[model samples]
Every structure is written in structure tokens, then in C-alpha cells.
Target: MARAPKTPPIPPDARAVLGRFETRGPVRSRPMFGGHGVWCDDRFVAIVFRGVLYLKVDGETRPLFEAAGCSPFRMSADRPSRLAFYTLPAGVNAGSDDLEPWLDRALDAAST
Candidate 1:
């Protein structure tokens, strides 16, 4: 049997963004490919990989990312596959200014 991978430690910056949500405290961390997934209420809300943070939003909330010029994280042999998440452009995820809106979208998605 294959052993489950271990989750990486949350980055201080990423943790700061996730801290804004009311449901943030109970987040579970787990390894996903080469990154870490943040889960709340058993649902994945975000991921941090290669020093970039990606927010998980469903179709309804997907447009917000599109508007920001963010793209789906495509996994290839040279890169980690994003699977069910979309990553914000570089520098955006780490900024508090850019972080809230995406986090809000994730929170909203989680609520529905």
C-alpha cells in the first residue's frame, strides 16, 4: 500500500490570508502533489505550491479569477498538476490587497 504524503507547513503569508475567514481556524493541512491543501469543513479551499497560493472556487466563482487574468493550474511532467484549483498570478496571492477578494470567493463557495 502506498503511504499518504505529508503536508508542508503553512507559509506565514498564506496563513495570514486564510486567517480572515471565520471558518479558518479548523483548516486541515495535507500534502497534495508537491504542495499543501487547506481544508475547512472537509472541503478544500486553497493550496500553496511552489511558493504560490491558489484559491479553490467553483464554476460560479471562477469568473472572478478569469477577470484577474489568473489561469487554471495545469499539471505536466515538469510542473505539479493543479487538478481542481485555479492559481492567481504571481505576486497576487501574497498581497493582502489581492488576497481578500479571492479568499472571499473561496469563503462564499464554501458556504454554498
Candidate 2:
């Protein structure tokens, strides 16, 4: 049998996070597997899970995130799978101006 549809609206916290990207272009979210996928101008750039935002990272940007003490998004503690997304450094709010640089990088990475 097919799984039931997930049509729950984006949580308030997720909306607040995505709001920061609105200036970049059209920002939208879609619920997926208990989290929300964030898109900017139709480009998939980030994910909000458990209220934490993770931005897409490529080889060029992964080092930047790592140097900033960010960790990759793992499926679970028991799983070794790691995605290309990484969280911002501790205390960096998703809506803060500090996200400008990182956000630009993530958008660039997503474009590729």
C-alpha cells in the first residue's frame, strides 16, 4: 500500500528560518520525512530539521562549514550515511545577518 500523504503546513520555526532567504528570491518549503526542504528561487538550498537549519555544501564550501565548526547532516546515530548539508556554527541564528555569507555560498553550491 502507498504511504499516506504529508500535507502538514510548514512549522512556524521553519517559516522564520526560511524568511531570511526571502530577499534572495522566492522562498518556499515542503515537508519531507519530518523536516522541511527549503528552496530559494526554485533552487533547493537548505533543510530545516528539528528547528535547526542545514545548508547545502559542496567540496568548496564543506571546508568552510567544517572550519566554522559545523557538522554534516546524518540520517541517524546508528547510520553512517552523511549528506552534503551542514549546520551553521553554534549560536548563529538562521535570521541573523551572519548568515549572509554562508547563505550565498549555499545558493551557489545548490546551483551546481
lDDT of 2 at 68: 95
For each candidate, the alpha-carbon lDDT, in order, equals: 0.69, 0.80
Model 1: which residue pairs collide?
A: 75-81
The TM-score values for the models, in the order shown, are 0.67, 0.82
Write the residue-wise lDDT of candidate 1 on 31-106 in tens digits: 7777787787676788787656777877798887777778666545577653656776567644457666777677
Off by over 4 Å in 2: 1-14
Q: For residue 109, what is the lDDT in candidate 2?
A: 88
> The CA-based lDDT of model 1 is what?
0.69
Which residue pairs collide in model 2, if any? none
Flag regions of model 1 displaced more than 4 Å: 1-8, 22-25, 77-82, 89-98, 110-112
Candidate 1, residue 76: how far the Cα is off, in Å: 3.0
Estimate, for each residue in 18-76, the C-alpha lDDT of model 2 and write its tens digit.
68778899988888777778899999898877666789999899999999999887767
